[model samples]
Target: METVLHTDKLTKTFGRLCAVNRLDLEVNRGQVFGMLGPNGSGKTTTLGMLMGVTNPTSGSFTWFGERATHLTRKKIGAVLEHPIFYPYLSGQKNLELNALIKGADPANIEKVLETVELSDRKQDKYKTYSLGMKQRLAIASALVGDPVILILDEPTNGLDPMGIAEIREIIKRIAADGKTIILASHLLDEVQKVCTHFAILRKGSLVHTGPVEEVGKGEEVVEVIAYHDDLPHILHEFRGSLSVKSENGKFLVRLRDDFHSVDLNKFLFEKGIVASHIVTQKKSLEKQFLEILQETTSHRQPT
Candidate 1:
């Protein structure tokens, strides 16, 4: 795959804080990459640097296989944490300015507005639009120039469920057209649904990066909900092959490194206890994220 964006040893420091540590990233042409981390994990700062708004303390990045320059930046589009627009201008008017500034065809104004499903409200004053609507307009501006790469930082931050779904669909359609996209969000479910690959960061450093599904793959996990008083003794049946995660009335079981869910379930069933419920689940991006974050809790430096 062709790399549309690449970074090497990227770092950013402010006074005594390291907002972003030595990080390397790669986004292939047409791939939708996700960045998963909590607030202050440098996701926003990283995007700011990638968009040329902030200077990196020590590192290098390239767009379109060449060092990022004002000229090459034309191929990128972005919607940072909050969208910016002229409150007094109409939605269409704001987009018109963005279109012209990017040197895009004036007719692209309506095309992008429609893509973001904001065409019906194009004439409304920016200040009159709801927060979610304003975000849609911001995305419209980014899409006007038809950039090959789109970078969004918490694009769905303030949206309700329906609004979130709307934006997610729009992004998927963009990627379907073969444009590369990079989404930075705290919503693990959203990332699981939209991205092909993801990287998880903790304390300004990356802890995991791989195909989305693979990142969530680890030892098998099962949730057992049984109304039994002697659950602890029942758990002993799984001792040699199952690592007991919790013994609460409802239990979470981690299959021994070498055991599979099927084998474990069969064992539980043979032990004469009614397994009220058994759900096989992957390790989950959230689980992996928290686990890694715990590892770095003591090492976390103010950033």
Candidate 2:
């Protein structure tokens, strides 16, 4: 599979501080590649360089297999941070302005408006539009040229629940149509739902980069919630790696990889401990995200 975007030892510095360290990234065609990190982790800076807004202090990158040349910018559409629109112009007019700048077809205005579900409010002035609507319009601007790659930074910020849901669905549909996506977000749940691959950055440095499922790595952790006080004691004896979490008057024991649900049930029954709940947490993107976050946090000293 051909990579739509590739970076090799890309670095950026702002005077005394390094905003983006020597980072290597590869985003293949039709894959939703997620960049996950805390604030000021160089997510924005990396995107800026990739989108040609920021200059790299050193290193190299390629888009669509060619070097990061001026012509490659035409094949990509991007929305970075909060979108700024002309408050006085109608949504249609704003998209028209961008479409014209991109040298895209005027006929695409209606198509993209419909794609972002903004056809009904196309005539509404930008100031009258909701935050979600503005985002939709921003995304519509990206879709107008029908570019192969879409790069978005924190696309769901300030959106109400419904608006977030709408954007999530739209992104999935775009991916289904085979457009490559480079998404940078702090919204772990959103990333988990939409991303096929992920690269986690910490303090401008890349920590973990692989398939989304790789982060979901580890043993199948089964959680046994018990009401008895002795359950924790009994659990400690049989576990290789256990996480004992207490909540709602019960102890939640995360069983080790070698333990089976049936084995735990049998042990609990024989030991005379009442099992309140036996829930298994499936290997999920959320679980993986949190593990990575915790690991990163541990390495940093409290100031």
Candidate 3:
């Protein structure tokens, strides 16, 4: 639980607009921390300030318990957007050049290529690789420096399902090796599956922050599907039912405190409703995310 990064009231403004306001965050070593928000919720601006590409208007940050500096920045590697590499150069050659620029040892190039699963295609020209391969190469380039932390913004943007799965696996692999990663993505599913902890940002302010596992832990949620048309109304009228939502031909019934799935099943039996499917489901991250946004809608500032 060593602190790898800390920000104190980090603020950034442009002319009359405040892009980021009084942001405070702490990331620990060996953590895959996710920063989640909409496109204009200051996720990118906060990352820019942390990476030294954009100066902060006020506040400060520290890396490895030391104040931000050139030396401290070297311990981190980042990819803010689509990476650009020489189209004509081979993937291996491109990584060599990147290592030189970062002052990383040339000897680490082969290991990083293997780490990103690009060893077989390392000799292929950068332009010849698919979109997925190009992205893997970018990650390989970032790992060549042997950084303690890696920062990625929208690492799976514009990729197919297969490509997204590949990147997700690679990220999990990196985290398994005890490297700290700060990932900024609007994809709630990605954060739920990959990150240990997450912070939700709304209108440049924090709305919620907590462990992904603890979301909706105390709530009772049950999924049911019945052929009868009156199933929805029946569920709504059931005792202890808080709400019922339909998705993909299934009804998710959330119950009040002390109400269990057994109570729901017993109620359905008494109503003579035969369910075709029934199971308890962990509350999904998407559901929780929407609820959080709805609760904060009135408190949001104009931006």
The candidate scoring highest on lDDT is 3
**At residue 214, what lDDT does model 2 achieve?**
69
Worst 10 residues of 2 by lDDT: 213-222
Assess every candidate by TM-score: 0.85, 0.85, 0.85
Candidate 1 is scored at a TM of 0.85
Quote model 2's TM-score. Answer: 0.85
Show pairs that collide, candidate 3: none
Top-TM-score structure, candidate number: 1
The predicted structure with the larger lDDT, 1 or 3, is 3
Model 2 over residues 1-303: C-alpha lDDT tens digits? 997788999999999999999999999998999999888999999999998889999999999888876567767888999877899999999988988877889899999999999999999899999889999998998888888899889999999999999999999999999999999998878888899999889878898888876654555555677667566678766545366666765555666667666777777787887677876667777667678778768777564
Q: Can you write out model 1's per-residue Cα lDDT over 1-303, one digit (the tens) per residue? A: 798888999999999999999988888887889999989899999999988899999999988889888767667788888999999999989988887778889898888888988989898899999989988888888898889888888889989999999999998999899888999999998898899999988668887788886865657777777667776567667754455666555677777666666675677778766777887777667777787777777456655
Clashing pairs in 1: none
Candidate 2 C-alpha RMSD relative to the actual structure: 3.3
Ranking by lDDT: 3, 2, 1
**Candidate 3 per-residue lDDT over residues 1-303, each given as its tens digit:** 799989899999999889898898999988899999988999989989998989999999989998887776667888887767999999999999988878899999999898788899999899999888888888888788899999988899889999999999999999999999999999999999999988888767778888888876887889999888889999999997899999999999998989988888889989898888989887888889998898899556454
